[model samples]
Target: MLPCPLPVFKGKNCRFDSCPSHESPPSSLLPSLLSELGVWTALLFSVESRLQKGQLLSLVPSQLAAFCCFSENQELKIMSGKPILHYFNGRGRMESVRWLLAAAGVEFEEKILKSAEDFENLVKGGNLMYQQVPMVEIDGLNLVQTRAILKYIAAKYNLYGKDLKEKALIDMYVEGMRDLNEMIMHYPLCYPGEEEKNLNFILERATERFFPVYEKALKSHGKNYLVGNQMSWADIQLFEAILMVEELKSDILSAFPKLQEFKARMSKLPSIQKFLKPGSQRKEMDPMGLEEVKKIFKVDEDLFLKHMS
Candidate 1:
């Protein structure tokens, strides 16, 4: 039997392009054919497969290499090892941290936990979080809470700040964003119906408390990154925090024009933009939940929608 065609390309995992079966379209028909094809999932997968096969061919350990490459067990191992594990809630707090790790090109297994017990079992031993929404286990070490994980992963990936001052700045913004995110995530727990004497009392209290601090932080930093021009874990944390608030109660940001501009810049990031689109492994925010939160906060819903663009 003829083997599958090989396509050719290169990246961390998935090699379909290098398949031996891969063949160019007749030179004359290449451009028109490609234009008709648009994004080439099939061709790309083929290219990836061919590449993997080539790597297999290069294994020169004779008998052992031949057995491992030809056997089904090794292929199973390759498939299983492709993902790293991540534990999180669909809520923005954990989602933000999850997205950043992916943005940084980390491989992970994703575990979505809905209950408290799920969290407890997952934590090999708690280092930080009082709750379980976001946790990570890296090479036998388990970490709880979003910020702690972000800091360690960032430093490991060379995404953290360059110096002590920058790292300090990272901490400053992360703490601020964390405080705000906690309040926002917990908003529904204290919800009260409208016209029952006051509108969205719980949200009102949270907004009054958190937004002012966020505003001041923006003001203190002169509207750039918290520390320096380089992208730090802090920036990533802050960006995710703001997205939650924006998803929940957007008009809350109008009061802080600096933060609003920052939000705009953050949403445009190539990684973020692609992730927000349909079919990203990451999930999008709940539009109705956002609207409900806005109503609770008495924010300008129309203004918030304008920014979703």
Candidate 2:
């Protein structure tokens, strides 16, 4: 009834310090407050009623001009029809999707949540179809699941394949890369006293099991991609996974010459290069050191080593 008593507005150069809601509870508080079904529904009703009658112009705190401009621009953006990608502020399961979007040169909106509370707010609001992230809103459909989202975007851009056989091949490669990713996750890179054991397992078991498959695929595919001798969603998935492995072990790709070449090839692509550059959209890898883990977890080195051994 009182116009929600907050700005609830965002613009390119929004100045929050001078706004009445500047002292509003921590960012999470408002979302939590508005999340109540009754409260949010009422607020939305009021907002919608005002919007329909064009009486919303007089409801602002003297920032009417800015509000009007922001509203018009947002309408134009919505009318122009860009897809919206919703995910946490990490590359975990979204990098391949980002790659596909970037490579396809499609302009999409990113809703990158910065905190766990923000994600919970979305869940509480039922915005996510599966109550999980890495969801995307595109083509009038809200899609969930990383692989499904990636395949959908790729298919739209012709990166999935040109024929049934190629699609099957891409699926095979994508599944293999997923398995490889699972293996890479097994290494406790941050566990104290287990660094040696973890690194050894990574170098010995994981490398032995996964690297050769990728190497063979790259070799047979002419060193550019994993299937059809052209870029596909699988290639982007594998390349992004390789970047994660490199963050854990700098030399993970050293022994696999072909994989090394593949990394170089993928890195040189214009879309991927832009994605890798320093930016908020690019996922940050702040790997925890063994020493830090030792301190924080209070791990007894002797016991740890004995158990690991």
Candidate 3:
């Protein structure tokens, strides 16, 4: 039998199924390989030694290319048939995409860019279009745009709607959520002087205008999901958008009973539960700066409570 393509297994008994050229090593072997090769060095090895010994002579050109110096983590990821999601350390725009990925049960590697240098390198390497993040590398294709990525994953995992009209409705709902997001994203900096004004605008004008639309939509649908009696990309987007509002103000959604129930139901989903559990890629919910605003503006406690209420 041909030797296994893995370095540690290279010249030893090929423990993997179907010998060296199988689609993937057995899962039972993963613990040992991870220990021997380290995480990043997972599958790559110098094949020159194996070539001189004629161990890999049966491999095709494509197989040989895969066995080259490049890391096999990507290959293994492809073998697992899941995508790699690249985003900044913070949730930001990628939260919905992450939610969709989890809800769809698509295993994905989260590449968190924690520094400006890391982001710049990715942009300089031409991996990101227009130098923006929330990019996904899946099945040999790199995709950008949060909505597009979510749609692609949803379609892949069958989380999207069942028909064309259902898809259109899903798109419509997602667009509305994006509109609400745009309002809050208007001033991410939240300058101390404008913090109270911005909060008031969101509470009074934006909330008044947007929240009722969603509340009505939820009641009209009369389902746990936002669209078509099932979870879709739209549901995930709206959920994350509501989460952002919750982070900004704890009591914002109390008035909308249907939405409160909707949030509770989605949070209870198995995939969402796994995503929310500690030690995952999930980040702590930011207070969205009510306290920071009070401290920065030196506002009195009583006055702050009155404004927030």
lDDT of 1 by residue, 1-309 (tens): 212222331123322333432233344544564455333212221322332321222222111212112111113112222224444334545566566766675545676654445545554355434534355666335565556666777877667788887778677766766666655554544434533323254346436765566567667867566566656676677777666656655576766777777778777777767766786667655534655434432347444322110
| TM-score-superior candidate, 1 or 3 | 3
lDDT of 2: 0.60
Candidate 3 deviant stretches above 4 angstroms: 1-78, 185-187, 285-309
Worst 10 residues of 3 by lDDT: 50-59
- On a 0 to 100 scale, what is the lDDT of residue 69 in model 2? 20
Candidate number achieving the greatest lDDT relative to the actual structure: 3
Worst 10 residues of 1 by lDDT: 62-71
- Residue-wise lDDT of candidate 3 within 34-125, one digit each (tens)? 56533222443343322121112122221122232223322221134357778645455666777788777666788766555666677778
Candidate 3 TM-score over all chains jointly: 0.67
Q: Number of backbone collisions per candidate, in order?
A: 31, 0, 0
Against the correct fold, how does model 2 do in TM-score? 0.62
